[model samples]
Target chain A: MHTATHSGALMAETTSTKDAEFGAWMTARQPALLRTAYLLTGDHHSAEDLVQTTLAKVYLSWDKVQKREVIDGYARRVLVNENNSVWRRAWKRRELVSDQLPERTGRHDSYDEGGSADLWAHVATLPRKQRAVIVLRYYEELSEAETAEVLGISVGTVKSQASRALATLRATAHDRLGLGEEER
Target chain B: MNHDHDDLAAQLGRQMRHEVEGLDRAPLSLADVKGRATRIRRRRAALTGAGTAAVLAIVVPMAMLAGQFTNAGDDVGPATDPPSVSPGPTEPPDQGPVVGVGESLDTADLPIGDVPAVTWLENGSVLHTADGENIRLEGTYEDVVRYDDGWLGIGGGLAVLLDADGAETGESWVTARNLATGQGGDVVLFVADGELRLHDNVDGETTVLRDGMPDTAEMIGVDDEDTAAYNLVGPQGEPFAALNRDGEETIPDPGTDAYVLNDVTEAGWVSAITQLMDDGTCSRTVAPNGDVAGETCELMFDRFSPDQRHVIAGPAYADGYGAGQLAVLPVDFTDGDDPVLELLQSGARDATLMSWGWEDDDHILVVTATPVDGSTDMTWQLVRIGLDGTVENAATPVRGDEFAFPFALTS
Candidate 1:
């Protein structure tokens, strides 16, 4: 009886210690994860929800993620995969909010403060896969190979998607935002 | 890269950084995440335990029956003595009168056969068989529907046309939202830039079907006759169904109550649903000319049978998640005769009918999960129920969670 009690207490102490370490790691990584998730979802509520789900998944496999350096990569993969699933299921819960179609306008018409918001809005309009590539390559600053690995696609796909997305953005910037005159 | 491209890439990175500069704090705490993890772990454990229990539930009974047969022979004679065979029963044990209509079989004695249809996702790819040929799609498609001689793979803001052998036919479309296909898969109807358009796969011609459609208009189903059905929000935000024949659209009024269009038949007949009471909804069939052809109360129909002669339906609401009573009703029924042909196999008081699809004209394929001894875990099996009330197993019973079954059994 005494041995059983001692073993139970030791197990509890070990679990508590492991949890504290995990908590500390999560605290440090939470801000960056939130930012990445926001860029992926293009909305604040969805980004938070995505992060929460991703963190829970990461915690489930915490023991397997042994190396600290590889943690970010592991979490990013989970985040991107989860977002893919979300987009797939989004149609089921879609609600028709308006009876009239919103009129299309140049991106710069609303955002005169700078062209950043316009560029962001245009980024949001890209296909989901292309958007992910741009976010990883330009925002996350991941290399082409790294972006491909994260998205489970070939490096060639990464390069092409990035190229197509950049071309669209460049054209939009020139046509709508009236910037990049030197390149022209 | 050129200097111009390099400058733009840098600028993009800067804009992204600026986008999230204000979100300084995370919304979730470590404790919150851990709590969610704990719940997920508990649920998985419960499911695993239930699976084990379901396996035992089947195995133990079979073992007992086998033991009974062995003992019966042993009781007839000693090892060295001449064995005197006892006469078998003259007639099979009388199972009470078969329930419902047609014929019935013991659920335990269902015959296993090849699955009629199968599709699944594997490692970011979609794989399915077309005409006994294995077809693989490596593109990022969220879903694919078998159409005409090929498949329509939709996702990543594009709809790809693949041949029967899964090769791209070099035809694709940029899809925004609300896409549907005809019963024969020959034509694709989609809403893009507030315009409803139809693409004829046969002629490879794209033409505008309707313009100035509300953003909320969703293409539900298109018939081989080129008639399309869609759901849209009314001026008061009430949901209503509309049909577009050729280039003209009409909002069919079955009555004062609004009905949501569920499906459209190849002949342009529509199956719709409307709330009849607080307890359940009612299903009705409407003709292409907006005439009320038939109606059945309390049951909501899902899809027409393969031959379009019958429809599979269920109660307006299931008692539990995936747990419900399913019935088959003839599409054409007179006022005096009974229409509901209750499926005896799905009459299980504790089983969950997870998913179902039409196997053929006469059989409906159902994936059923029976709870293991009142626990959360369940034993899964593929069952086929015939319109004549015959029930059989289409595959062996599997003991696991939903992940154990790889095929997209639900149509």
Candidate 2:
């Protein structure tokens, strides 16, 4: 009975330590996660919701994730999957409308000054999967293999999707600017 | 990787970083995440238990059947293999009603006229209809400016003039920036090394419009009266100015707030967003004489209609990551009158407004993702929305994971 009580106390202490570690990690990484989520969803409210859900999933799998160096990757995978699922679920349920308007944040310094706005606009027009690849590979600076793993696709697919996405962006840019044929 | 590809990748990274820079972290707490985690754990546990029970029930029956089959197999004519049947192709699931405002009609129901348009970037090629022929423009260009006699193809920091047949005319400008057509495309205006110059196609001469201009100055458009409008970005803010034939500057009073120029009309009217506060932003148009032509709150004017009678706008400071509501407001409006003439709500959730352009003086063509009633795949449809609240599908839907419609026109 004494050994059982001691074991119980030790287990509780270990759980508490795990919780503390996860809380610290969440606080430290929340901003970066939110930025990626915003890029994926394009709305502040939706991005916040996505990040919250992603962190919760991470917490539930903390035991497995804490032992690996791919915690960020795991969280990112959850984020991408959650975003895809949210859109699909919205379509299935036909409840896409949100009652509250998305909250507006302050304009970042040098916004749209460097012609990045046009590029970003074109990025928004990309398909969801292709867009995800671009976000992971370009915005997050993930390698092709890493992007493939995060998206659960083969590396060859990652390469093709990234290529197609870039091509589309170039073509769209020309079209937007009323430019003709791409220089060979 | 190619140089252009590398440049694009770098630009994309910079742009994405710029988008989220200075954005405040969301107010989420570890406690909130933990609470949600507990619920998720409980639900998953319940599901696991039920799944285990279901597996056991199936496994017990299968085990008994296997034992009986093993005992009787030798006498059962080698247990004649059950007729193997391959599963047929699974049909796409139904997605439900098409989401949009008002009645939805097929593209055939609309009135037909000559829809002379161009669709570009199909496998690195551009196709346009000219004189009833589908002409493909040769070579890839960074920017193209259409003129009455020829096209100006800008790439690799050089602006090469191309004839109507997409052939180079040997007229080119080096290091050109912000090239735009003025005086009904009879001339092209551009800034080169802080000098605003005009190239007259009729005279085959290049003349300097104004010197000592800021490098950030970009020619927006030119009015019929030989007036050119341009905007400059400085530390203070972005302020738009107009220059007439006599080289006089008409700098509009942008009030005391920073403003971003959206579009400038051929009539020298400027539409811009100002007062970008935390609450919201405001959009207004300034006339050539520094008068406030029209103004609207909580919305940013995207572009002027082809006739310049109305402006299509969306929510100000909107991330525009998804489909949202769009509104059309008359360019000429009183202070107290309602600015919105019509509001087009994106009816379905997850439907994104991909590309939009003025179809004609009375209609606007918007390409949006339409959910397939039962499948995960979405179809792109060209929607024609009229000023009088009429919406119709202007083209047959094409199934794809990406937006496939390529005939997006500049508004």
Candidate 3:
């Protein structure tokens, strides 16, 4: 009976320590994760919700995430996957709002919200797969391989998506940005 | 071909930075995040259990029948099927070093349109351009701040605000230091005399938003609602301050000599940060009611990201001047006692980073200057550094040689 009691106490201690460690990691890492989510979602509320969901999944598989060095990468992978799923569902339910500007339309004459509005608007017009490539490649600065791993796609797919996205931006915004026609 | 893309990337980066700068969303507390996450975990666990039970019911009966037939013929097979041999561990695939070839200038003749930029010239004048039209403001202004519609600068013995087209907004005031803007569209904050004051220029009326505060009170910043944050010395000489839409509420005094208020986040929480003499540099987010929410320690906090989640710091100060090291780290770093920093480019002597800005959530634009070998003048370079340690020289946002310094790259 004494041995069983001692073993029970040990189990409790181990569980407590594990919880503490997880809590500490979450406390320190949540803000960075939320910021990345905000960039991905372009809104604060949705970003927070996405991070919370990702963290919950990470918690469930904490034991499986054996390598401490890859925890950040693991979390990023979960985030990208979750974002892709959400984007798919959102696309399915998307309605055509008449007032919404077309992809080819340039900025209005009085629209000077800042230089960012045009760029961001153009980015917003991109397909989810293409946007994800641009964000992970240029914004998050992830390499093609890391971006592929995060999105569960091939490196070749990342490269192609990025190329297509850039071409579309150039075709649409070339005149608006006032760039010369000379090919580099 | 890649040069055009790089320029496009740089333009996109600037836009992302602009959007992030004025973001004023309240930060999530540790308890709040955990509570929501736990609820999600429980819901997911329930769904997973249901699915597992359904799968198990179907598999068990089938497996039992198969096992009986297989057992009858077990003697015909090698005794235990010779325990399956495991393969040796293999090396993980790596993509190797980051590509750095696309640093060349793009002289593409961009169409003549509104180029939103604030440019400083060699002759001590400011050039404001909107839609390819340039208007030059005469005077020697040291620096300029950009807003959505216009820019604020000091020139000709007065503070000035110019529209995107270079026309003066007819609002001018005495020059001040530490300029900041809040949600009050054209409203701006600056230090006057020994006190902090706000000058609102919206609707052609200039009004003083706040005045007559203690000289010891230094304005940290304002939030989305035009709320101001100040760090002031208490009556007992300890650090006491408050963040409020208006400074009517009583300021709370933590009564600790080691820490003082450094920043006020979007959620109105006060950040109690350490002083230089403290054992280690750190910042802790605390509730308005004086409850500590989270704490983070790091070597230094040169500047915080627009979202306030990460910080750019360096150990150059430790070497007493010349460029030593620069890195980006999460504000709440927790890899043992030592701060975990992703080191960017380093080892250049006598180089000083003058200004840095976020290009995106995980990318930074850093501007550095180094003294010329023979002359007192300094050469400036713009660099784009990523959290993954990808470093590349970036083309300046402004076009032409008329204006040398880039003040702001606007929409």
Against the unseen true structure, what C-alpha lDDT does each candidate score?
A: 0.60, 0.57, 0.49
CA lDDT, candidate 1, residue A136 = 92
- Predicted model with the maximum lDDT: 1
Each prediction's TM-score versus the true structure: 0.46, 0.49, 0.39
Q: What does the lDDT read for residue B263 in candidate 2?
A: 60
lDDT per residue (tens digit) for residues A80-141 in model 1: 86675444222221211110112223222222337766778788766566788889999999
Tens-digit per-residue lDDT, B249-282, candidate 1: 7666534556566667555555666432222345
The most accurate candidate by DockQ is 2
**C-alpha displacement of B243 in model 3, angstroms?**
3.7
Error of 1 at B227 (Å): 1.2
Q: List the residue pairs that clash in candidate 1.
A: none
Residue B367 lDDT in candidate 3: 49
Q: In terms of TM-score, which candidate is strongest?
A: 2
Q: Model 3 - which docking category? A: incorrect
Provide the lDDT at B349 for model 3.
Answer: 32
